[model samples]
Target: MSSSDIEFSSSDYAVQLDLIGRVNGLTAAKNFFSSLRDQDKTVKTYGALLNCYVRVGLIDESLSLMKKMKEMGFLSSPLNYNNLMCLYTHRGQFEKVPDVLLEMKTNGVSPDKFSYKICINSYGARADYDIMEKVLQEMDSQRDIQMDWCTYSLAANYYIKAGLKEKALHYLKECEKKVGNDAEGYDHLISFYARLGNKDDLKRLWDLQKSKCRKQTNKNYIVMLGSLVKLGELEETEKLIDEWELSCKTYDFRVPNVLLIGYCQKDLVEKAEAKLQDIIKRRKIAIPNSWSIVATGYMNKNKMEKAFECFKEALAIQTQNRGWKPKAGLISSILSWLGENGEVEDAEAFVKLLRTKVPVNREMYHALLKAYIRNGKEVEGLLVSMKDDKIDENRDTMKILSLQDQNSEVTG
Candidate 1:
């Protein structure tokens, strides 16, 4: 059928929306809705407008139109609500979605695969596995709804993000039982187990390799190993690396923190320092985190000066291009080093220049502490001042305390 040969009616509105979606007629669709909305034509026109906006990722408009269509007495439908919910979901907009769902129930519409998936993904984004599992339970309760691999994959993501590795493994294992041994889920499960430093699971995965049945690569090995390192399962991690004939140097920055940390552990200062530069040579990868790992390694090997330099470079590079300020250690390292170097005045100035984050002025308190101890500059007044204006103990503050005046502070 020709384009004009098509009849534009309520039943056919969705189909027309698909055609216009392909042609990118979003504005035309919206203008058409505004211009030609009589009671008879309004429902279809508004629905078409909603579909067009959703197609173009104008989800707010699609949601707004859903409300207008409902107010105009358009009947609830699986296709309509499903599509609208999907649009809301792609934007990660969950709060608005349940209201549309309520409207669906009010209009006698039933939830289907699309609505179910949206809820799964939204809850996963929030890492609210309790509610995410509830969604799965609710879906299971209704015979009309069904779960697919993507559905279960999303649920598994909820567990992973929430640090419920055991729960993730259980859900993925259930997925395997239900779906006859899925390889992707198994790979992911192994990765999670490796992250948790679960010896039994890691051994099994390794034994599978040793039996001449499973093929492993640096990519996959480091992917798992690096995750374990970040979780700080250091002793188990060392043994695993010694057990496996694995190499991590070739992995991307996403998983190469292991290489950095391993170099630090072995006191391979230059190798640790070069990992960041190696990652930078790759195309189109934002490895701001490589510096953090490198800095730690350098610091461990008594290379604090170079570590400080690397941190500054990383923070400056990250902040300049991406508009994201570094945190968790970037500022802390600077303040800590400035205190150690007895450059408290310079550190105080640097703290003020932080564009987005507020720094605890601990360097001043502790700086004076060191000053009083080293230079004997009157502790009576300084002690009272520090007590009154103490730094609130955050993670960075705690790190400063643990590492202050560390004997291993140096650079190669």
Candidate 2:
């Protein structure tokens, strides 16, 4: 558009700068902002650049730009201050967030709904319930402010965390009154009810959500399913999953993974694996973590053989889920099991596949050495490989080497 005959407005330049920051990194965004003519450096463009700096977590740069924006009288709106509050919140500087709100008020800029919400959240996060309640009261008293379900829900969440059940229920009731037909609002209410272990309220709100909300999304199902699971109602969870499957347009594995996790948490590994296998039988796509979940369940039960089988399944189709990696503790346990009880060839093959995901570590080498020694196989080549990999022999390595020597003496 810059090269075209189209006239670019300040808003267009701001959007372009935002896009550049997101796609090309902060340096490119800074360069683009610098290239802008003085007239083009409007509040919109400056705010966009400031947003970029906040997004990339450049604290010094964000503050410097905010100072510049303030000096130029561009801090007339609540947006600039809100961005700073968000930055502080994101960086875990929750205590500083309220100070930004105070600054906004001091500058004669009235705090918007989001501005008040952020301040409330910051106080809640700090466990400063006195100040949080005071802020909420002030926000409620503001004539221009119309409190939404989200604010009430957020306050209720913090109340729940503080173990103030009555206060939490009050806010939750207010939240429900404002929910109207919003599915996300119902989701929060459902989750909070579950946290409170109020199964009846959970069911009531769920029914209400289904009746009022036009559609129940996958996220909705996940939340409901997870809530039921949290209440230890696997039967209800199963029924909900069936309901979701009947109407869902697209199959999302995360929906079932919720129950899979629930089953494992309840020490029902066989049930979880059986459910996973049932999904696989239907040719439904299950991610690697699904198998890993079952594997972890078996590991906890000390069923190493079963764990090995399930984890092997996870590794076989790992390429299908590139982002999935087995947990380090689980991997270590499996490697140790393979070294002690697995076939020498099996250990080598598993390690070969494992190396692709994690760095070749001392645990991998030790597992291989144990397997080779147990099988009465040659260790010279294996030691050479370890040396090539720059894995220095430690105490465990020396102990395994001593075992290998003892085995050689017996075999000789």
Candidate models: Cα lDDT each = 0.60, 0.93
- Candidate 1, residue 408: CA error in Å? 36
Give the candidate number with the greatest lDDT.
2
| Per-residue C-alpha lDDT of model 1 across residues 1-412, encoded as one tens digit per residue | 4366765565565465446656767666555445543643655555666667777788667667767677866756666787777787777777666666667777788787777777777777766668778878887787876665556766766787778877887776666454334444445656656555575775565455434434456555565576566555566555655444344334344445675676666676687666557556753444556676666666666666777666655654564335444655645565566556744444444443443334446654564445333433444565465467654445644454444334235311
Cα lDDT for residue 244, model 2? 88
RMSD list, candidates in order: 11.4, 2.4
- Count residue pairs with overlapping backbones in model 1: 3
Q: Name the regions of candidate 2 deviating beyond 4 angstroms.
A: 3-5, 58-60, 283-285, 356-360, 384-399, 410-412
lDDT (tens digit, per residue) of candidate 2 on 66-107 = 889889999999998899999999999999998899999998
Query: Which candidate comes out best when scored by TM-score?
Result: 2
Q: Over 4 Å off in model 1, which ranges?
A: 1-64, 71-110, 120-138, 141-146, 153-170, 178-184, 191-197, 202-222, 230-253, 261-292, 296-304, 309-412
What TM-score would every model get versus the actual structure?
A: 0.48, 0.91
